[model samples]
Target: MTGSPEAQTSQTAEKLPLPIRLIDGLSGLSAALAAAGLVLLALNVFLDVLGRTFLHRAIPGTIDMTINWWMPMLALLAFGYTEKMQDHIKVTVLLDSLPIGLRRAIEGVFSLLAAVLLMFLAYYTWVDAARSAKIGETTSSSPPVMIWPFKFVAVAGVIVLSLQLLATAWRNFSGRLPREIDFDVDEAAL
Candidate 1:
C-alpha cells in the first residue's frame, strides 16, 4: 500500500486470504513448471531432430511427450499468471466509452460468469483426471506414458483461473480493481 499501484498489487496479493495466497502460490509453481517444461521441450525437440537426422534413431516418445505432456504444461499452466496480470486480450472500445459505474457492472458480471465457467471446467477436469488415473490411461505412445498427471494440471489451471476470476469480480464490484494505467491522461488534459 505504500508504493505504486503495481507494487501494491504485488504486495497485497501475498497478503490476501489464505486460500487466495495458497492458490497464488500454486499458480506460481505452475508457472515455474511451465518454464522448466519449455526448456525440456526445446531440448527434447533439438535432441530428437539431431538423433533422427544423424543417428537415424529419434528420441523415443518425443512426439507423444510433447503433444500429451509438455504442450499442456506449457499452455495450461499460465492460466493464473495471465489472469492475474490481466494479459488476456479485451475489446475495450465500448467499455472505455461507458460510464464508470456501467463499466464496473459489466466487468463484474463478466468476471462472475467467467468464474462460474472455470469452476465447472475445474470440476469436470478433476473428475476426468481421477477417472483416467483409475483406468490407468496412458498416452498413445510406443511405450504409452501415463497421462493422468497432465489432466490434473488442467484441473489445477482451471481452479486457479476460477479463483482469479472470483477475485476480479469482487474487486470490480467493490471499485477496488486497478484501472489500466493511463500515462497520457494528465498530460492530455494540461
Candidate 2:
C-alpha cells in the first residue's frame, strides 16, 4: 500500500498547483510563528508558577497576557499547516469502501462545500477584524491589551485555510489528488 496522505503530498510538494503552493508557504510561516508562541507560552507559565510557588506572588498579568495575546496566536496560527498536512480528523471508512470513481466524486463535492463554508468564515472574520481595529477593541485587563492584532491574525489564519480548501477542491475536480503512490520499499530490494 501507499504511505499516508501527508507523505504522498510531500513527495510531490514542488509540483502542487499555485494555490496549494501559496497555502504551503504561508503554512510554513505560520508553523514557525506557532512554534515560537509555544515556547513563549511555556516560559510564561513556568515563570508564573515559580513566582506563585516560591516568591509568594503571581506574575502580574500572566493570565491576561496568555488569554489576550498568546492564546490566540497559538490557537489560530497552525490552521493552514494542518490543512496542508492533511492531518485533520476525517471519517474515511465509508469513502474507502466505496468504488474509486464514486469516492472521488463524493470527496470533490465535500471539498467544494468545505471551501465555500471556509470562504464565508474568512470573510466574516476579516470584517470583524476591521471593525475591531476601527473601534480599538481591548481586553478587560488591568492595562487592557489591544485585541485587534490578534483578531487580524485569526483572519489571516482563516484566509489561509480557506485558500487551502479551495485548492483541495480544485485538485479533486482536476483529478490530481488521491495519489496513492508508494515511494518506499523498492520492489528491486525484494
- State which candidate has the highest lDDT: 1
Query: What TM-score do all the candidates reach, one by one?
Result: 0.82, 0.79
Lowest lDDT sum, 10 consecutive residues, model 1, at 177-186
lDDT of 1 by residue, 114-137 (tens): 999989888888889999989988
- Deviation from native of the Cα of residue 177 in model 1, angstroms: 3.7
- Tell me the lDDT of model 1 at 69: 85
- Each model's lDDT comes to 0.79, 0.76
Total backbone collisions for each predicted model: 0, 0
- Candidate 2 per-residue C-alpha lDDT over 1-190 given as tens digits, one digit per residue, 9 for 90 to 100: 2798687667777677666777668888987898888899899999999999999988877887788778888878887677665667877757765666666678778877887898898899999999999999988777677788888888877777777676666666666653541324456967
TM-score of 1: 0.82
